[model samples]
Target: MAPKRMPKVYLVRHGETEWTINGRHTGTTDLPLTANGEAIMLKLGDKAAGPGKLIDPTLIGTVMVSPRLRAKRTFELIFSHSPVKPPMTIDERVREWTYGDYEGFYKHEAVAARKAKGLPSGEGGWDIWVDGCEGGESAQEMTDRADEVVRTVRDAHRKWYEDPERKEGDKGGDVLIVSHGHFSRCFLARWLALPLPAGQLFVLDPGGVCVGQYYHDLGKTALGAMNLGLI
Candidate 1:
């Protein structure tokens, strides 16, 4: 069998929304990006997805986007000027963590509400990775969803690398994922084969981008870059 080729994956968290600015647990909410958010994303797209940039447009094999409008719009802005626009796939696995009853509530508000109801808030407070949202997905569930995306993208990468009809100098194998914050983190954790809770340690700001790739020639998965912002 031939050796597997190392393929890079880029995770882009959608730009700012009204709920994001208000610190609300935005899950399954379809809100458009603010004007400022759109502007920043455009700039980031130019910087990261432009020619001779970190995410070379010509090298992108697949683009996976969350079904939410916010995520979809972010993808639009980021690739608006790309010379080579890869086909996009709307994957539910990349959707934001479903907040359930906690949806639209700020973290502190959710904590206080849970306290009022005498619900256990864990050691410190309402840590989603620990407590998850009431009536929502557990950490394991999130991990499962993220794993689905990872598997799909990895398969795509393998197919791209092993394509016998691939043209010379094509270099097309990278996968790009445009999704939500918590979901993106979960995707990264799943990509690295780490525990779901480990995703809590990392923060992906609105409009931020992270890179995951195999190091040492596909011997080990590695995080090449994270929390990269245009502004």
Candidate 2:
């Protein structure tokens, strides 16, 4: 059999939470989705299915998500009407970065605190990707976690895609990863085997979906799209 083609991974940042709307670092806070967040999630399902870009609503594969209520609810709202229920799992590896000291603080306030101490902007002040929080993991640590999650997902999909006995339509794998904004960006970078600092290059908004594709023939990976289906 030919080498299996890995399926494209679709990552959706959970809908707007109170912290998200306020530009705060949420990271494992388990906040509920805002009213508008709910509305946008419903729209996302329709858009992904309506266009030929993603798997049809009836198609089945996997919908792994963070165990947090916000992430789980987003998955439920999006796939509520699908005829075929895909396998769902909660992978802690996909959870948001642990914000530690910065948790619950507004973005501006967080930046101000870093600046007060003469720290840099964008990513606290742990030195680029380093976690500036007093007690939380650094950016490099988050990158390590994200890398593990991507590796696990990639290995699983590779196995599924290589199952020769599977039918043609069943050959493809679709992963709906529901996670928080900052960590999602890190995951995207890891998916493309990019440097941890590269995560800052992408912005992941609530209810945004980023697609990454691995081109086997070309021996490379590409960010198919970013911040798609935003409302």
Candidate 3:
């Protein structure tokens, strides 16, 4: 068997929604993309997933999408123009972080509500990475789910790497994941074997695309690119 080659994973956040534009904690809320969001995603798809683009559609082997309408729609728009359409599977693990009581509340409002209820806030305020939303999933729980996703994808990649039919320099082993903002960040953190709180430092804007890949060794993963937008 040939030595395992590092594989790249593309993390894509869904297009803009009303709550996303308004900076609200949009968790478990199924919101559709706005007109502008759809337009932006169309352009992004052409630039990022088109031939000779950052994400070559032909090279994509696996596509995992969140079950949310916004995420599903974004994935559809992104590959609508591509010549190759990879099979897509809905993974509940890729869904957005559940905000529970903080749902529909803006950032400031969530912080204030937590304070009013005598809940402890991090030094930087009520960050979901630390405080996690009340009545929702804790950081540990989210980490567990995200880790499961990582394992699933990695297991598939390992099979591809071990396949004798695969040739060198073929990046077709890449995996594409379409999901929400916060959860995407968490997914990236877990991909690098970092703590969930470390996700707080990463930011994935609407319609943004980030790439993660193994470094010198297949066991070590690193961020290849992030916050890429359509030029």
Could you give candidate 1's per-residue lDDT for residues 1-231 as a string of tens digits?
444457789899999999889888899878999998999899988887766787777788788888999998898888898886777789887899999888888888889988998999876768888787888888778888888888888787778767787545657788989999899888888788988888887789999999998777554778988878665
Candidate 2 residues 25-53, lDDT tens each? 77767788999989888888666642243
Q: What is the descending lDDT order?
A: 3, 1, 2
- lDDT score for candidate 1 against the true structure: 0.84
Name the runs in model 1 displaced over 4 angstroms: 1-5, 164-166, 229-231
lDDT of each: 0.84, 0.73, 0.85
lDDT by residue (105-152, candidate 3, tens digit) is 988898889889988977756878877778998888899989998998
1 against 3, candidate with superior lDDT: 3
Q: Can you rank all candidates by TM-score, best first?
A: 3, 1, 2
The parts of candidate 2 lying over 4 Å away from their true place are 1-6, 49-60, 111-128
Winner on TM-score (1 vs 3):
3
lDDT of 3 at 90: 92
Worst 10 residues of 2 by lDDT: 50-59
Q: lDDT of model 3 at residue 35? A: 95
For model 2 the TM-score comes to 0.84
Instruction: Go through the candidates in order and give the clash count of each.
Output: 0, 2, 0
TM-score of 3: 0.92
Model 2 has an lDDT value of 0.73
lDDT (Cα) of model 3: 0.85
